[model samples]
Target: DVKVTQSSRYLVKRTGEKVFLECVQDMDHENMFWYRQDPGLGLRLIYFSYDVKMKEKGDIPEGYSVSREKKERFSLILESASTNQTSMYLCASTSGTATANTGELFFGEGSRLTVL
Candidate 1:
């Protein structure tokens, strides 16, 4: 079965601290994405990658960065965390296969980060 695992289900950090959120997929999907879910904003994309070593900024890329060094793993980096950055972060992936017309995404449980 395909699975996406997030490194943490809950996290807490203080202001000006660095945070790392990791996600891994066993399905070997070609596309991976990072999103933050807030009460009003819904799911907002923070970053995404189509292949290993390649990344693109999403809707809200400020205060965030990404790394895709391997095919199965992706990491989101917060250089200096702040209260504004606290939220539920999600990691997802897609097969990107030609035969699969559905742009379905497999998602991890999610990691909630709290900044004080």
Candidate 2:
């Protein structure tokens, strides 16, 4: 089974602080993604890494960045946390194989961040 683990379930920080959200996957999937969920914005992709050391900026990457140092690990970095950035962050992984190519994503519970 593919399992995605997040470092924190909830976080509270002040404005302008640097924040790091870590994600690890048990499966050696070739694709990993980071998304932020807002009340009405739905799930907006922040970043994604298809291979180690290779990353692509998603739709909303202005305040976010990503790192894929290993095949099973992907990290999201908030350079300067802000109140507007408060949202539920999700981590997902896909095998990109034929059998598992149902266009489904195995996601982590989520990391909710609150900036005050």
Pick the lDDT winner. 1
Once fitted onto the true fold, the runs of candidate 2 whose alpha carbons sit more than 4 angstroms away are 97-102
lDDT of model 1, residue 5: 99
Highest-scoring model, TM-score: 1
Q: Report lDDT (Cα) of residue 84, candidate 2.
A: 97
**All candidates' TM-scores?**
0.94, 0.93
Model 2 reaches what TM-score against the true structure? 0.93
The positional error of residue 81 in candidate 2, measured at the CA in angstroms, is 0.6
What do the candidate models score in CA lDDT, each in turn?
0.95, 0.92
Model 1 accuracy (lDDT, Cα): 0.95
Error of 2 at 40 (Å): 1.6
Q: Write the per-residue lDDT of candidate 2 for residues 57-114, one digit (tens) a residue.
A: 9999998888889999999999999999999999999877346355678899999999
